[model samples]
Target: MKSPAPTTNRRNGSFGHRSTPEHLGYSPTSGHNSSKVSRRNPMAATVMSVIGIFTACFTPPDTNNSKSFVDSEEFKSSSVASEASRSGSHKARGSSRGVSITLHNSIQGEPAIVKFTMEEIFQVTRNFSPSFKIGQGGFGAVYKAKLLNGTVVAVKRAKKSVNEKHLGVEFQSEVQTLSRVEHLNLVKFYGYLEQEDERIIVVEYVPNGTLREHLDCNHGSILDLASRLDIAIDVAHAITYLHMYIDRPLIHRDIKSSNILITEKLRAKVTDFGFSRQAPDIDSGMTHVSTQVKGTAGYLDPEYLRTYQLTEKSDVYSFGVLLVELVTGRRPIEPKFELKERITAKWAMQRFIEGEAISVLDPKLDQTAANSLALEKILELALQCLAPQRQNRPNMKRCAEILWTIRKHYRELSASEFRSFSTSSQRSASTKE
Candidate 1:
């Protein structure tokens, strides 16, 4: 367990409710307790594609620290040349040598992106020193590095875990998706490297680790209610942006807490795009796109699982599970339970329906006196998200608004306590004087 937060921002809300909300009920559902997790019912494995966090082995050259990032004329010329040369090479090279290619997109406001060479990346990463490594996922490991011009960055090297046919496609998907959208809650992409048989992507380095680190791992902070509330709102806003803020919608096939990175101030940044896709145009009469389902377990939309049809609602359904994760702070799959009782969303929903919403909350936030209304609202939202039918779920926009409202209400309650504390402290100081 982590130490408690300092007094200044310590959580404050008087404990337990006068009574549990009248509508809150306790009912249990049967699924995924002792059995395999299914989005709906288990399907033919081939029809429901599944992939885990990807990683593959790579050989990185030792030690090069003299690579300039900001003012490298060589980067511009070399990258452009590499781009020109890359047009014809489709066969897998025995191994890729890192190359920084520059290409001009000169389309009005669109800024050009440059690729970094493997040597240049290695130099910055001190030859991929283990000490500098910050994270690892299905795709690869991430290292923290500083360029010659003194710019700090995160370099993600991909593992060759992808199929030969889809090896380069993942990288392309991320680049295309990230470049096309911009929002405070989304991670910023800097550049990419595909050389020396190593695929790498560079993005702005978020200081704090993932929300998963804070929640399940108990990383740096206690992740109090206020912070969690803020995170919930932040992520909802991000998903809303992805769903409607762009000319063409993008579905972030994965939206688990692990994928949400916390910034220095604990702001949420949604990262990773290996499985994102363009939304089908409804105006064209396509209600849902039938694509292979790709997402982490526990967070995949059940409707998508059963029907093989994907929609924005699938994302909403996943977000519902995320809401439950936020409310309960439990892993989606709990091996501790009999497999059938193991799916956390199902378990949490059972607890919520049983009028134990407060009991199901993280012990860290479980108060004996404060009313459970705040949590009840959140539970209601989570259930709405997890509604069996996709149409029953609220759109991301409404979800964001509701979350923001809940977060604001939570902050208001905290503010009252903060004000009272300040007044009492000032009175004591003056009395001492």
Candidate 2:
């Protein structure tokens, strides 16, 4: 859900609820390079547990492994950025000519997304050509373009109507949050362009569209049981990192399918940090930090919605809704369903509590092929995540461990099923010949 206009400073307890479009895109609401330096981060135990679970059997290569994807060549070429941001003779209609600036690595100690000049960005996008627009959201329109260095990127340009101060906040909020964290499961920030009436952020062009698109029928996509389980574990790891690994816990206020982008390799990357806020400092010993409510309606935690206070657990609650999506492949709010079943999470939880949760599996997944035990365990995990009391919920760390176990079960089952099918096919071919 889009946040309303500013009523109060976010730093304090006060928050403005006035409805206004935020840089954050819409859905029901919803970073990797930083990963390599800290290979032995505290979350290693959970990672190892996951690796052990699935790798114990015939391990399929992590083809979607974001760990191996990001190299120096995958980012902006040093050769192009070395020339610096020099303004050319031509300028865009709205802004001033580009002023050259040397691009430096982020002070956060990681390679930064390449900084671009207004002129260069405009040239790459053909002066914001309508045909090039890929998507529009609360933040602004996203355009796909290729830089002079041949790097494909998505540019999120702020809306013209948003005030300068608010736009500046949106820009800085994204850069500040994304720069501090990186993992294969998060979207990579490329660079940004901030100039007169223009606040644009350039990020890695995630080519596979979004999780929402695949779930929606219009896209003609149907993910099998194994693919869904893989995505669930991938997202859980990202949230685990955000809550436990980062210097300060971050509350990702929005956590819905639309904000979750899928890569060509089918790796899930979380994006849209407009409403993100830092959790209470470690020394405070506070269980929760009070803030204004800002999240999509269906996915928002009931507790966080009722109380302005936010916590790491709020993300767990939202992730529960995500799990429901993975399990049932249904929207958070299914208005077309019967009145009693309108809310996807409520319906799923009811079925799960009644020991019939498996009935809700995606019909496209071939129910006969699904592993009952894994489904039940993941459903139980979802229920625990959706607990009304935030404390009752497993933190993202525990959630990741549970999902890892489920993924291991499902992966082994899928691989065995594939082998059996292959054998059957070979036998049939020989008989026909």
Candidate 3:
């Protein structure tokens, strides 16, 4: 559902809904190295958890107990970023081009955001060639570009329309928020170009596509149950880091499937910070950040929609919708379903309560004993996340822990089932002999 235009006051808590086009191409979200670092740095934990879940559930048993999961090459590469390397080369090029003045706060340890000249931007994109265009959103069109150093990046060019006042605000908001945080599961900020009518944001290119695309089978493969669980946990960790670990808490107003970028390894990286805002400071006795409501239709928190009081829990509410989406493989709103079943979360929860939760599992997934058990537990957590009141929901940190426990149980149950089948096959072979 797209809103027409801005028609309400933003300060008085009135919402003039903003509509972003459905981005079907690769999201310009991911990371490169930066001098700025996260305070409580959870990248190590994220790498360990990701390796553990995928290895135990999907790979053959690792008989070499001496090999720690973290020692694997995949995660080791994730810990070390190439953004710092790529950005340094770009800065030197910018200096030679006489655009060094455009750099924002260049320092010794912390380099400024790479300021790309309009000429360079045009050259990389071939003057905004249609063939290079990947997707479109409310802010602007996205293009895949290859930089001079051969580093692939995503370039987001703001629409030149003079009427859309919110586009500029959204662009700046995304830059400010992305620069402040760094995480394995969050997009990295590379640079920006704001010359005359051009306003562009350059971020790391996430090759795999949006979670929504994969869910819709646009990638020619269905996401298995283990992959879905890993995605949910990855997103939960990202949001939890934003809400708790950052110097100031932040709320990522948009948390839909389209905003989540999947990596080649199938891990999730939360993107689209245009609606992100710092949370209310509890030390000042403030309870919530009263602001204009901005979120997708079905994922918007009911409480925030009604009262216009945004809190950290508002994000929690949206995460709940995401959880439902992950398990059922259904969009938040399915227009073709019956009136009673149009809202996917509501319908799925009703079925869960009615003891028919198994019926709603995505047809693509083969229903097994482990899958069924995980479905019920995941839905139970989703129910809490979708609760009408924000206080009733679990915080993102708790959500991560619960998901971890769920994954552990899922792995154990799968192993037991596998062993049982193996033993049964052995008996049958003996009898035949």
The candidate that wins on TM-score is 3
- Model 3: lowest-lDDT 10 consecutive positions: 71-80
Q: How far is 46's C-alpha from truth in model 1 (Å)?
A: 30
Which order, best to worst by TM-score?
Answer: 3, 2, 1
lDDT-sorted candidate list, best first: 3, 2, 1
Task: Give model 1's TM-score versus the native structure.
Answer: 0.71
* TM-score (C-alpha) between model 3 and the true structure: 0.76
lDDT of 3 by residue, 1-433 (tens): 1111222221232111132222322221122211113201322232223222221211222335321111000100111122332334544735543322366663433335566778878888999999998877767788888777676778888788875556667777777677666777887666788777788887778778888888889899999999999999989988987887665668988888888888888998888888888887776677898877777777777677666789988898789888889988998888898976777877777666656778889899989988888887787677667666676677787777778878988888989999999999999999999
In angstroms, the error of model 2 at 292 is 0.7
* Top-lDDT candidate index: 3
Residue lDDT tens for model 2, 154-267? 878888873666556656777667655666677766567776788888776866777777776545667666777777877887787677655555777788788787766666
Q: Write the per-residue lDDT of candidate 1 for residues 1-433, one digit (tens) a residue.
A: 1111211212123211232222313221221121223312332121112111101001111225321111100000000001122222322211132333455343443334456777788788899999988766666687888766565678887767636446466667777676566676777665777665788887767667778778865564578767887888878877877777566677888888778888768778888887787776776677898876567666767667555578988888778878878878887777798854567777666655555667778776756222254666676677667766676677777777677667666666667767887999999999999
Q: How badly does each model clash, as a count of residue pairs?
A: 36, 18, 2
* Alpha-carbon lDDT, every model: 0.62, 0.63, 0.69
Error of 3 at 245 (Å): 1.4
Off by over 4 Å in 1: 1-101, 104-111, 338-341, 368-371, 417-433
Candidate 1 steric clashes: 36
